[model samples]
Target: MVSARSVAVRARSGNVTRRLLTGLAAAALASATALTPSTAHATPPAHSAAVPAHALTGYWQNFNNGATVQKLKDVDDAYDIIAVAFADATGQPGAVTFSLDPAVGYASADDFKADIKAKQAAGKSVVVSVGGEKGTVSVNDEASAKNFADSINKLMDEYGFNGVDIDLENGLNSTYMAQALKAVHAAHSDVVVTMAPQTVDMQSPQNEYFKTALAIKDFLTVVNMQYYNSGSMNGCDGKVYAQGSVDFLTGLACIQLEGGLDPSQVGIGVPASSRAAGGGYVAPSVVNAALDCLTQGSNCGSFKPSKTYPGLRGAMTWSTNWDASNGNEFAGQVGSHVHALP
Candidate 1:
């Protein structure tokens, strides 16, 4: 699911610190490990208690990505869920670890943990995001599935993170990933879980990303599909629509809304500014309009939904740092709009 724009952006920036694990290596390593009971835990019924009725999600970059370098305390109040950019892959298959980038200026892990605690005290969820444009950690087999769950649960315990976000850009194994998530929940019952799949991932329910979303829909918090970096795609109506337009937002969102996902589980993910992504940089007004169109049937482009979904979850941005770099317009405007949704 890596987009051309994302590749170009990363290449031009030359920030290659993010690790890459190929599918073959991941598979081989996963097959070699022994499966444990913890990893084989069955998924319980879906239920999440942390997310707000209509929430605003923003990714806080752990590394310096030319966006504003922000500490956890600096994230905008409008954001109810602040996802830490990524958790790093370890030598062991499916194992991940996190370290604060010195570039972000955290004096110590304790300082960072305190910030996380403060955010939680304010009723905001701080989650660790796994996988980004360069993320390729795979959890295909049972052993790796257990490893993934144990590692993430360890991170949650160590960092006091509220949850985890699945942003695997290369590929996903829904069965094992679902197993891993259920195991994670088994360890932390009130955990908040979210996904940030690319556009094509949600175009059809048969897609692996969509299947994973459906497999864990009961407890899944939200699916904020990246609406940028994607070229033209088919809307729910089967019409091709280009990106950076309200039609693209509303039309594509319809597929998830109508395709058996609860309206509360569907959200629009976009860049905070033009610089945040290579393409699909819509104005905050368009984001608000898309929200309005989906929830109220007003402010719609040519592609209107057959019905309005007042319970439609909300919106998400690539990085809160980008929003801060851009005068916080996305959070100030779109965040306000999302909170006001009926």
Candidate 2:
């Protein structure tokens, strides 16, 4: 099967130009400094209540894609970390900005910021997501890395965002991306850092996404690998598992779990409903079963782990809008199950 990510890239316009620019910028950045693995920054005190042990993360789309448009305050209580999707790329490379999608019906940016504060007050983390399937922002060099970190920190201060979500699906440079995230953590000691890499990106520790995740594992919250839109892939046991199965979820997750990621830093990411993605939609029951298999070693399919990860982080969905569109079945069932994980 064709790679779902490659297919999405082909369907969109300007990707070629974006890739070219990213390559040029990366070359310029690399020449300026010899890139090396980044050192972990000391974690600072959290700005607000810490995320729940077993949490649900959902993307709140900045633009409507036929799914229910929602205000931040209107997001369901099931989500503990609400990622505002697709922070816009700026003229300056690696810098990103966010504006409320007028389609979402917010009267002003102030209203949106207030909603963010309200969510933080309610113990939910509101983070600005930096990329999407079509995201073009690239952090390939020291300068771009600094720009990325500064801009994200600025957004956090301006909008009361607790942290940032790295969803740069197009491409990533592990060295500089790691540098940028370390700088952000240095500035906001208690920031919540999350990542949403596609399935192939985390297939091995050598992959850029996996490398970046490991570089900052000390302070990383979770790496919620997208398990949908991907066809068959190898799990930790080197078994080829197709998407939309209990084995698929548990098996792929084993790569991260066994590849040096803390159990609390690995999560399962799935589409909330069938309409949410091109393919690989599983019922919420399946998601819950996968969680059970990982954390409790029960409800497992053909593949089972050598040990249980009781501290496993929990699950994430593509978008809250899709969940609402599907009658909140994902949230009601999977959400409850995630919170009940022990």
Cα shift from native, residue 150, model 1 (Å): 0.2
- Each model's RMSD to truth, in Å? 7.8, 7.9
Per-residue lDDT of 50-69 in model 1, one digit per residue for the tens? 57789999999887867888
Q: What clash pairs does model 1 have?
A: 46-218, 46-219, 47-219
For model 2, how does the per-residue alpha-carbon lDDT over 1-342 read when each residue is reduced to its tens digit? Answer: 113322322343210000111233233244222332132223332446788778899988777677888898888999999998868899999999988778999999999988988888888998898877767899999989988888887888788888899988788999999988877766565678999998989999999999999987767888888998888999999899998899999999999999989888988998888877777789998999999999999999999999999888889987898888888888899999999987
Per-prediction tally of clashes: 3, 1
Candidate 2 stretches with Cα past 4 Å from truth are 1-47
Clashing pairs in 2: 44-189
What TM-score number comes out for model 1?
A: 0.89
User: Scored by CA lDDT, what does every candidate get?
Assistant: 0.82, 0.80
